[model samples]
Target: MATASAVAAPPGEPVAAPAPVPELDLDRYLGTWYQLAAVPQHFNLACARDTRATYALDPQGNISVYNRCTTWANTVNDITGTATINDRETGAQLHVSFPGVPTQDRLDGPTNYIVTALGPDYSWALVTDPSRISGFVLSREPALDAQQWNRIRAAIETAGQNTCSYLTSPTTGGRGDIAPLCST
Candidate 1:
């Protein structure tokens, strides 16, 4: 689990919303992505290993989100959700809603998911919420090289997120060295 609960600005400090990437290619972004690291959330508390998410285009042109992870008991926990574009022009800001998950189903709230940064080749991405409370580090592979990790750290700082808040996720054939992102 992550050491911090939320990443917030200093007391009484006004902070701008986290900006999304200039643009997002939905087609290229749609696929299975390994959850390399993230700010632990209540919903994912049970996840013990092999956390990954898959995105696909539904018939209605919306993005379908399928997330699964292995629990300590060796059971696979799965959840399906939908992602709707919040910024049509950039396609980088989105609102993801999981049917039975209340935390992700806020329809009238600010965009809860923002793709703040992406690798040049779309191989990795940094995501966060408007408040900068929640964040995720996703990659095409379960593990990344040292250089890639450095770049990701820079991106997280650039996005106004606290590197110390991110906790690495464990995965098979990847990294299970769960540690705070800043510790790298």
Candidate 2:
């Protein structure tokens, strides 16, 4: 499970965020983000390949999360979630939640979702938490080339995440196909 590293501070007092982007443009950030790589998580164990996440902004400024992945067992798995900005000033920290589960802040505390890095043209992004326990490499394309991967790897290190912890995720030949295959 992911945990947040928070320094003790008086209630309502200002707190600093770890490895968060200086600013975020939600309009540019919204849309499909393929999961190129990630730190292993129990919930994502079954996701053998083709993991993806789509984001949409609500009128209330909340973000809708649509996550999907292909299992080695040749099945499609998905879940819908929501992310609310934890801090309005930076727009880099967010709190996410799935149905029937407690919010990220409630379950893991604040700073559970942080935009650690972003591509210049919004082609890719790297998200991490203050704890550095969880992270994801997202891209507008279904797959990333070696050069892009290297760039993202550098960004991960810059964001204070462990570069060695990430493993590449497979894809449908960069087609972004969600269909399940019967056999490997």
Candidate 3:
């Protein structure tokens, strides 16, 4: 079970400029990544920290996705979803949603999901929805080395994220510890 924190508001609500979208190399963007940190959501609440997602091409020309998360009780939960390019020309944006509850329309609206910054080898990725309603810090593994973590933090700051609201996922114990990862 993957857990998420409260949904965050878009940038500039109280104050501050919106975060900038960075150039993305789509070719290198396809693959698997561990959800190191995210603006928690209800759907993924069961996931116990070490959550991961894999992406691949589907026959219909969409990005096939597989997400897995471990629950506090040690149960494994997984979900499959598909993503399509919002615009073929830029290929910088996308729309993704779960396949469960099939009737619910896939969240196809234009999302900020911009690749603000990426590692040379795609080892790390910084993704955010345009409204800044959602953001994620992903890596190839559950635990990122200090250097990698710092690098990602710097990139988030560079993108104008209010680190004060960003919270860290607890590795063990409790319903899920929710505390600010950085100070204002």
Candidate 4:
């Protein structure tokens, strides 16, 4: 999951845009999502298993983001962030960041997050930033059946990500709130 570099434009070339998605209902999307797999990032390199994110609506109508995971030696790590809608029409475009980071502006900047794919019943979701530097497969259940995994694979590819490149996150079997469901 890698998009054209945002600053790698060769003189006149236009930067690539994030993948498009249909309408999204943020209300229905607000809940806990287990991370099944992801394209590793430097910040999350220590997250070894049971990675999950929770989304809640604040009184200000913005999204409150809480992400947690277990690292080596059963260490738990968590962080809080905020998300805002960049495009009201689709409700699929957003920019999110933790407090104290510069460039918090959602507009005049990159709408890094795109809801590239979501399950019909909100059972799973595929997320990728505009830069495509990061990608994640999320599910409501800790474990996914074979059929569900197949669909997840398809969703990942649909969002311009390689399934083989994804490092499976342990949800059920690992030592954490949720055991590792998939193997590493």
- Which 10 consecutive positions of candidate 1 have the poorest summed lDDT? 1-10
Candidate 4's residue-wise lDDT over 63-171, tens digit each? 9989998887689999888888888898998888777556653323558789988878889888888766688888888866777777777776666556666777777
What are the per-residue Cα lDDT tens digits for candidate 3 across 1-184?
1112222346665533234334455557778787767777676688766677788888887788788888868998888887777756557677776655453347465443566667767788777766565667777655667787677777766656655445655443321455655631
Candidate achieving the largest lDDT: 1
TM-scores for the candidates: 0.90, 0.79, 0.74, 0.81
Q: Tell me the whole-model lDDT of each prediction, alpha carbons only.
A: 0.87, 0.75, 0.65, 0.75
Clashes of 4: 8
lDDT of 4: 0.75
The TM-score obtained by model 2 is: 0.79
lDDT of 2 by residue, 7-95 (tens): 33478965444567788998899899888777888878899888889899877767888999989899999988788888788788888
lDDT of 2 at 99: 76
Clashing pairs in 1: none
Tell me the deviation in Å of residue 120 in model 4: 0.8
What is candidate 1's lDDT per residue for 1-184, written digit by digit as tens? 2223234558797667878999999999999999999999988889998999999999888889999999989999999988889898899999898876666665334588899999899889999988887899999988898989999998888887778899999988878778999887
Candidate 4 stretches with Cα past 4 Å from truth are 1-12, 101-109, 173-184
Best by TM-score: 1
Report how far off residue 102 is in candidate 2 (Å): 5.8
